[model samples]
Each structure stands twice: as structure tokens, then as C-alpha cells.
Target: MPTWRPLTPNDITGLMQVANEIHPGLPERPEVFINRIALFPAGCLALEDEDGRLCGYAISHPIRRRCPPALDSVLVEISADADHYYVHDVAILPGLRGRGLAAECVARLLASDAAQGYSVAGLVSVYGTEAFWGRLGFRSVVVDEDLASKLREYGEDAVYLERVLDSQ
Candidate 1:
């Protein structure tokens, strides 16, 4: 069975390789991953397959409500006014998609210390993945002008989705 572990700087190379294969059109720089890992290590994770190979990764952090960072952009710092947990990115290798790894990773992330206190978790669902995210409890919300512009950076089909994280 595949499992998720804390991502370290050393995992970036392997993580990027899988990211490229999985998201060729929507590429993010290594610095972005580095920034996220540096900003909130607890929210950074690497997925290791049965043979202990890096197969995927998840990047998340707290952010101001409705202000998901643009794809491939660097953050100077986590928002000081952060009121939400933003699921920045979660990618699984193609072959591993249907095995429930993405859902498992999401559940783990939502329960992490970094995710605590956030009333909701939000993500910019790219690659026509709104339905997939919806199955995980996210629902698309109408955006205003400022946010609508930000979503443009993700691509035409990008949809902003969020799920209430009922406190435990």
C-alpha cells in the first residue's frame, strides 16, 4: 500500500518529476514547492508507493479566505490574516488515481495541525477536476471580481471549491 510522509527538500526532485508527468500543462517551479515546504512543513507531504518510490505529493497552507495563490506563483509569506486552509496542490501518479490515495491524503491534511482552526478548506480545482473534488465534500462557489481574476491564472475550467471543516 502507498503512504504519505512529510516532504523534505531532498524529495523536491522526485516530486517535481511526478508533478511534471501529472501536470505538464500547469507547471510550477521548484521554488514554489520550496516556499510551501518552508512556510508550513506540516502541510507538505510526499506519497511513497509500495516499493518506496516517490509517486506523488500534496502542498497546502493557510491563506486569507478566497485568495488562493496563483498557479506557479511564490508566496512571500503565509497570510497574516489567514482564516482558511488552502489545499494548494495534491497530485497522484496516473496509475494510482483510483486507489483512493488522493482522498486519503486530503483527509490527513485536513486533520493536520496546520489545518486546525480554519473554518473551511479551499482549493482551485484545475484540470476539470471540480467533480472529483466535489466527491470529497467541496462545492463550487460563485466568486467576485477580484477572485474571479485570480482563478483566470489557473485556466478556463478552473473552479474554486471549498468544504467546511467542522471542527473536531
Candidate 2:
């Protein structure tokens, strides 16, 4: 079993390894991960096995509705009045699949955001993984022309999804 904890600067290398394994061809520069942690430490998390080896990571933060930051780009700052808690990225290594670590990490982040009074959660699904996020209660939504154009940077198959969170 693996335990989930807040991500620290020390976990960057392991985080990149998992990111490469799960998100091939996606932009996952170290500075992006570092900045995410700097901006929202609580929303950035790592999963570690009993031996204390990191196997996965999740990065999330508050963002304005219908607006997701561009891939591989760093946010100057997170919006304090943002209406949606956005799941920017989550990845688990191939060997660790089917063990529910992904779900556990996402659940923890969503619950934490809900407790912080965010009524909605959103993610941009790529790599034909919309069904995976759908299983976690997200529903696909048609974005306007402008937002759809922004999502294209993630890849041709990128889909936007959102879910209303139950008040904590």
C-alpha cells in the first residue's frame, strides 16, 4: 500500500520519473512542478510506498471557471477568488496501476478543496482518459470556441470536465 503526503522540493526527481512514465510527450518541466508547490503546497501531493519511495504525484490549484492554464506554463499566481479548483495533473507509474493510488490522491485533493469552500472542481482530460475522470464523478462539458482553442494546446483529444463538489 502507498501513503499520500504533501509534495516537497526534494521529491522533484521522483515526480518527473512518474510524470514521464504516465504522461509521455506531455510537457512536465521541473519548474512547473516547483512553482505549483510554491503556489499551493497543500494541493500538490506525492504518493509513497511503505519503503518511502515516491510512485506518483498530483498537482492542483484554484483557477477561474472555463479557464485552464496552458500546458507546461507556470502561473504568475493563483487567483484567490477563483471559482474552480482545477486538477492540473495527476500521474502514477505503470507498475503501480490498478491499485487505486490515483483515485486516493485525487479524492484527497478534491476533499481538501471542498473544505476550503470551492464548490466546483475541473480538469482537462488528455490521452483519451475522460472516462477515467468520469468515473471519479466528472462530466464532460462543451467549451466555448475560445476555451476549446486553449485546450488544444494539451493535444487534439483533450476534453474539459467538471464536477460540483458537495459542501464539506
Candidate 3:
């Protein structure tokens, strides 16, 4: 079985390996992970198997609605007035799909201390995963010109999705 644990700087090597294998085209440098962990440690998670090997990772942080960070870019700082919890990224090994790991990750994130101030969660769905996100309570929402432009940075198929938190 795999369990979610706080991601630490020591896990960067394995984290990068998992990221490279899972998101070859949407690569992000280790600095991004380092920055996210430093900014909001509560939102950084690493899934490890019983053997203590990294199998997946999830990164979430409070961000302003209609404005998502660019792919492969580091957020110098979290928003001062961020209104929504953003699921920045979640990647799992192919072997771990269909085990509800993704949903568990998001559920834990939404119930995290870092997510307390947020009323909703947002994400930029890509790689034809709109249906998957839809199943997770996220629905595609049209964005303004500027936001739509940012979504393009992820991919042409990218769609902005949002889910209102149920107040746990």
C-alpha cells in the first residue's frame, strides 16, 4: 500500500524522476517543487509505497480564481488574497491509476489546513482528462480572454475547471 506524506527537499531526486516519467512534455524543474514546499508545506505531498519508493506527488496552493500559474514557472510568492485552492499538479505512476489515489489526494488537500480559507478548488485540465476532472466534481467553466490565454500555456486541449468546496 502507498501512503501520502509531507514532501521534503530530500525527496526532490525521486520526485523529479516520477515527474519526468509521468509528465514528459509538461516538465517542471526541481525549483518549482522546492518553492512550493517552502511556500506552503502543507500542500506538498508525496506518495510512497511500503518499500519507501516515490510513486506519486500532488501540489496545491491557494491562488486567485481566473488566474493560474504558468506551466514550468515558479510562483515567487503565494497570492496575498488568494480565494481558491488550486490543484497545481497531481501525477501518479501508470501502475497506480484506478486505485482512487488521485481522488484521495484531492480530498486530503481540500481538508488540509492550507485549504481552510478557500471556498473552491480550481485546476487546468489537460491531456484529455476533462472527463476525469468532471468525475471529481470539477466542471469546465469559460474564462475571460486573459485567463483563456493562460490556459493555452498548458495545451490547446486544456480547459479550466472549478469545483465548489462542500465545507468540510
Q: Count the backbone clashes (under 3 Å) in each candidate.
A: 0, 0, 0
| Comparing 1 and 3 on lDDT, the stronger one | 1
> How many clashing pairs in candidate 1?
0
**What is the lDDT of every predicted structure here?**
0.92, 0.87, 0.90
Model 2 alpha-carbon drift over 4 Å, by segment? 113-115
Q: Which runs in model 1 stand beyond 4 Å of their true positions?
A: none
Tens-digit lDDT track of model 3 for 20-109? 998888889999999999998999999999899999999989888878888878888999989989999898999999999999998899
**Candidates' TM-scores?**
0.96, 0.94, 0.96
Tell me how far candidate 1 lies from the true structure as C-alpha RMSD in angstroms.
1.0
Question: lDDT of candidate 2 vs native?
Answer: 0.87
Best by the lDDT measure: 1
Q: Which one wins by TM-score: 1 or 2?
A: 1
lDDT comparing candidate 3 with the true structure: 0.90
- Write one digit per residue (lDDT tens) for candidate 1, span 1-168: 889999999999999999899888888999999999998999999999888899999999999989888888899999889999999899999988899999999999998887889999999999989999999999999889989998888789988999999784
**Per-model C-alpha RMSD:** 1.0, 1.4, 1.1
User: Residue 128 in model 2: shift from native, Å?
Assistant: 1.4
Question: lDDT by residue for model 2 over 15-79, one digit each (tens)?
Answer: 98888878877867999999999988989889898899899888999899878888888889987
